[model samples]
Target: MARKAYSRRARVTGTLMLLVALGAAGCTGDPAAEDSPDAKPAGGEATTARAEPGKYQTLPQPCRAVETGTLDAMLPGLAQLDQEQRQKAYEGTSSVTYDSDRRTGCRWKVDSADAGHLLRIDFERVVSYSASVSDDARAQAVYGDRMKEAELPLPSDPREEQPERRADDSAKADRDEARATAPADDEAGQGASPETSEKPGKGKEKEAGKSEEPADETVDPSAPAEGLEPRLLRELADDAFIDDQLTTSSSGSGQRTVTVVFRTSNVIVTVEYEVQPKQVAEVPDSASMQEKARELAGLLAERLSDV
Candidate 1:
């Protein structure tokens, strides 16, 4: 009996030890199963630190990106200008010229108003003219040419697309034939005569009159025309101001030139200037220019209000 009791005790102890060993094995993974030295994190959570707010915000000046396309679109005849003239118009203290390469087929000059922070304008796809402007004396001599080259073209007149009337002899002949075939019916009796054989001809004439041509789509008289508005330009200039550091100003009789402060938190800033014809010229005895100016001004006003 004593030997049986001892055997039972030994069996219970062995069972308990086996359970504890299994539990430990389950809790601790094998050393071979551990993560490798070069193993990536469990998910795509980046180990790098996050960038601060406004880190990638654009500078608050007239940047190359904004001006380049706008200028090219505004001034189609820019490329034809001479290099000396081009340099004079675009030359500045922080200007850098890049020669044309395989990727970019045209030479370009990039001008910065303040370091690289404010007012970067790129005169691209230009003829190489750095040699002409290298000396101060040469630039002075060609100053007029430079100014002319720098001036951007105004937006094209939208009314130039008006259709012209055809003066072909065939149309005249057709009209003559129609007039000759018409009955000599008076206007008052023409509609009253139900028994008249000319009723079918009149119906055809009515159809022809109806089909002559549809009137053009009605344009909103109050709507502004294409191009940047002066008011919006002023607003943007106003927004570009930083802590009362800069002042806005205008020049020319019709306020043709506008100067504004430009700033950005990331870098230094400076003044940016723009020139526009204050009022489009009016040809004497013709209201076209006056009308156009009014139309353009309305457009400018509308754009400004929207902005």
Candidate 2:
């Protein structure tokens, strides 16, 4: 009997210990269970956020970017210019870029009996250090700033209409008086109801009112002045504008400069072309210079996109 009781006691103790072990296991939770969202990942690895890389990793050699034929076409006076000056101009001067990948430029200038012409091409590959901001977006912001600085006029929307205001009080009063006298005249007319008489008379009066009202000389409030004209461009990069500046030198010769700025992806290209006619008081054609600059810009944009 004593041996059996001892055995029973041992069995009871084992049951209690087993229950305590299960309770401890339940309290601690499962070690091999699926991970909760709040917990760290399995391997303790973290993702490092980074901004997108610029489109062009390297820039074309600025001096060689524009071809010889293009230079000749852009500067008509190149052959007629002094030999020493023409040689110097043909070998364009390159900009000193610390990070050639980020920015570069080339410049050429020559003077002749026909005209003095200057051409400058600049390339800037935008880069953003912030992980949340992309290089292209940074470039877009810079472009917006350039547009604002140039004071480029936005294209007018045809849907937008402004109500004309009456500048003459006497004219408005006259129209009001005519409208008031119409009903009495219709009432006085035999067999002429107010509706019939007023309809035809009111039509005539409205026509007269329209004719008498002074035409408003509306002007685009956002347009830049005549001297500093900035116009939008198409068929180039994403967004672009051209600025035309005409300045007269002390010698009385006039110089017309056209600056074409365009953005493609993360790159911004600026082309500055100017023509100073040889004859005093003569001015370069803004349209002609703009076309030449745009042609050069398109070429640069094409090369940058290929890279």
Candidate 3:
């Protein structure tokens, strides 16, 4: 009985030792465990989590909420003419304001020539403003010259408050007369009277009027063909960097033309080349034009930054 009791005590001691060994193994932590194939390191710190490579850093000034009241104040007066007249002469359809750490400015979209033109105007105060017109020369012509002149009178009450009713009426009358005198296909074959034939100058005048009518009919003076793509322009303007391409092709001879504009906040670079008569032009030949465009874009971008 004594030998059996001692054997049971030894068995209990061995069991306790085994439990301690198991507990120690469970407590051990391996620092290299995360290095295993199945384990993933925290985001952004891992070698596989690098950002995609690209030119230009993120913009310093992001677009913010637009100021409609400021825009209204800045908008050129259209009160001199009727609504239809106003729509034809000016292109301030939509406006927005953005805030940057450095300054605040406004952007607007105007449709011209069935395309979009982006206009950005930066305001220093209620009385002072600066403007930038994008790549389109036609847009620049109207906005820079005509619209700029018109807006000079704004932020003030004009002494001549009367609407130009006579001007509007005369324009409408001229349009109607032009439409009436236009010749149809059937009318082209008809012979005129002896009196009409004698008065050749009068008939010529009528024919000239007919020819002019279509120009008036299709012309929306408010919107012109040289307008900018306002939204795209705004995006490009707001971005710290932009790389975009414009391609145009001629159907007559299967000729193609391409223009690329690459820009940064301080610089704009353009590359334009033509593929015509089934031949691509040499880069050296287009270098001057491209450089000129780049210079223009850079200057415009810098000016726009102020607004």
Candidate 4:
């Protein structure tokens, strides 16, 4: 009985030893590789991950963003400047900023016989600290707030109207047009009144200034040309809007400021063009001012693409 017991004990010990050895071998792995940055789960998901950074890491120098040739169109005073003054004008004054990487700006101002022009360009680089949100997303949020502040006209949605109602409205408009084309009985017997008729070149006079009393068909005396009013833009950048405001002082001097703001990726750009006419009666042309600002904004966007 003692010998049988000893043999059983020996068999149990050997089996236990074999199991421990196998377990130790299975647990064996390279400590260095396991801790390495490149080493990751073969089948399991990652514990944590960093998010993508913004596309723009640094901002461009604002002073040199606009070229001299472009400045000439935007700043008409450049045409009358002397050699030294022109060079100085091209070298715009840098705006005061503590951080160039995050924000930078340049300002140019010149006085001409017709008007005083001031151009300001600003660039902002947005960054996201969150490991989940991207830089572009942060920039988009900032731009949304800015758009809200601008209060530009939102595109009208035709689909929002009932289809049947829209059809009725279109029919009514057609009918109204037909009636307007038909001359009144008094006009048929005599002639159309000057106020009711619009000549070919008459549209040009209404552009910069208008003394005519506001009528149903006449454009506002203060507002810029018909299409150049403060509105959202579709062609300048990924997102952009132009704001034109004409301010008249007690002296009757008028200053029209055209501001163009746009965003590309993680960067936001702003172009402000102000024209204060020398004559109080001279209303700065909104179309021309907006055109110059839009052009400068486009050029800056292209310049940023290269960066």
Candidate 3 per-residue lDDT over residues 1-307, each given as its tens digit: 9999999999999999999999999998777885677675567354443322222222222123223332232222333446786555344332244533223433443332322223343321111122332223222233334323323223334445446865787799999997689653234445654443444366688888898785635643222123221112333342212122223333323322223333333222232233223233311123332333334344445544554
TM-score of each: 0.22, 0.65, 0.25, 0.69
How well does candidate 4 match the true structure, expressed as C-alpha RMSD? Answer: 10.1
Extract clashing residue pairs from model 2: none
Residue 305 alpha-carbon offset, candidate 2, angstroms: 2.0
Q: Look at candidate 4 and tell me the lDDT of residue 205.
A: 84
How do the residues 119-166 of candidate 1 rate in per-residue lDDT, one tens digit apiece? Answer: 222221112244433222332334324333434343456565434423
Which structure is stronger by TM-score: 2 or 4?
A: 4
Question: Superposing every Cα of model 3 onto the true structure, what RMSD results?
Answer: 23.3
Give me the displacement of residue 21 in model 4, in angstroms: 7.3
Clashing pairs in model 4, backbone N/Cα/C closer than 3 A: none
Q: Which ten residues in a row have the lowest lDDT in candidate 1?
A: 237-246
Clashes of each: 1, 0, 11, 0
lDDT of 2 at 40: 62
Per-model C-alpha lDDT, please? 0.35, 0.80, 0.38, 0.86
lDDT of 3 at 258: 27
Candidate order (lDDT): 4, 2, 3, 1
All candidates in order of TM-score, best leading:
4, 2, 3, 1
Off by over 4 Å in 3: 1-4, 27-44, 52-84, 92-262, 265-300, 303-307
List candidate 2 segments past 4 Å from native. 1-49, 81-88, 156-229, 249-252
TM-score computed on alpha carbons, candidate 2: 0.65
lDDT of 2 by residue, 1-307 (tens): 9999999999999999999999987889655554655556759865666778767667788898998889998877787867787777788999888988789999988777778888999988888888899988999999999889987667667456343433365579998998787644434566656555555477788999999999988874223356436787877889888988778777667777789999988888899998879897676776667778888888888887777
